[model samples]
Target: DAGVTQSPTHLIKTRGQQVTLRCSPKSGHDTVSWYQQALGQGPQFIFQYYEEEERQRGNFPDRFSGHQFPNYSSELNVNALLLGDSALYLCASSDLGTGGWAYGYTFGSGTRLTVV
Candidate 1:
């Protein structure tokens, strides 16, 4: 399988607006991760809802939030958008049973968000 999928291939929003993005994990993967990629740079971690209450996050502010459902799918929400928020939103899935990223994450092309 592709491992992950994201919606709204491209998005445009005004500053201060809110946005919600969706993701579906790869089969048998119980962990979902989100990342933000800016121009000419690698993706920056946003957050991850893993097995149990083990949650990992990056330096993002409260404006970013995420959730993982029983089905292992997830949603990423961003509030009070800023021009700096414009970038590619990436989703990755991994099987923690075999040591999460130890097995490498399967990622999608990502959703492009442009905050005006």
Candidate 2:
């Protein structure tokens, strides 16, 4: 089955601009979560979606928002991006009520965003 995928593999943007990243969940999964991982740092969850609704969220500014479609794909949007916003954006997919895969969530490589 196809695993999670994200694009563009990399991004470059200026401060105060807006950016949107996309993600497609693994086959048969119904939940998607967005995370931000700074260089050499662990991922910080931005939000999670299940059944096309925002089921959970993390500690992030309102500038960080996301959406999950009925097809289980998702998009993350950041407004007024700052240099600090530059980070590797990761998209994780899970089975929702099914407790995910045996090894837990399936994560995409990531979208490397560089805000200058």
Candidate 3:
């Protein structure tokens, strides 16, 4: 019954560099979603993965990509990062498919990325 966990609670990077963040989904969950939350803004859906395939994605650039493994964990990779990429990267977990409100999406505290 573990909750979602993200690695490197805080991170600092420079412009034009690449960074990868890891996430472990809650137990008994097969779906993982990534979100980017800027200061004082609601989380913006970056992408969602189910069955190891991307089911939906938002209007992010190609630089934002992700992968979901067999164990339902995930990793988000950003290449050629920019200052604008500095934000709270969140990883949420849910059951396969969507239906109930309670089991929809449970978000982690997130990995704070700071690009200078």
Q: After superposition, how far is residue 54 of candidate 1 from its true place, in Å?
A: 5.9
> What lDDT would candidate 2 get against the real structure?
0.92
Candidate 1 segments exceeding 4 Å error: 52-54
Highest lDDT among the candidates is held by which one? Answer: 2
Off by over 4 Å in 2: 101-103
- Output the TM-score of candidate 2: 0.95
Candidate 2 residue pairs in clash (backbone atoms < 3 Å) = none
Candidate 3 lDDT, tens digit per residue, 11-116?
A: 9999999999999998878888999999899999999888888999999999999999999899999999999999999999988745522657887889999999
lDDT by residue for model 1 (1-116), tens: 56588897999999999999999888999998899999999999999888533389899999998878888889999999999999999999999888999989999779999999
* lDDT values, one for every candidate: 0.90, 0.92, 0.91
lDDT of 1 at 94: 92
lDDT ranking, best first: 2, 3, 1
* Candidate 3 colliding pairs: none
Supply candidate 1's per-residue lDDT for 49. Answer: 88
Candidate 2 residues 58-112, lDDT tens each?
A: 9999999888887889999999999999899999998966775455999998999
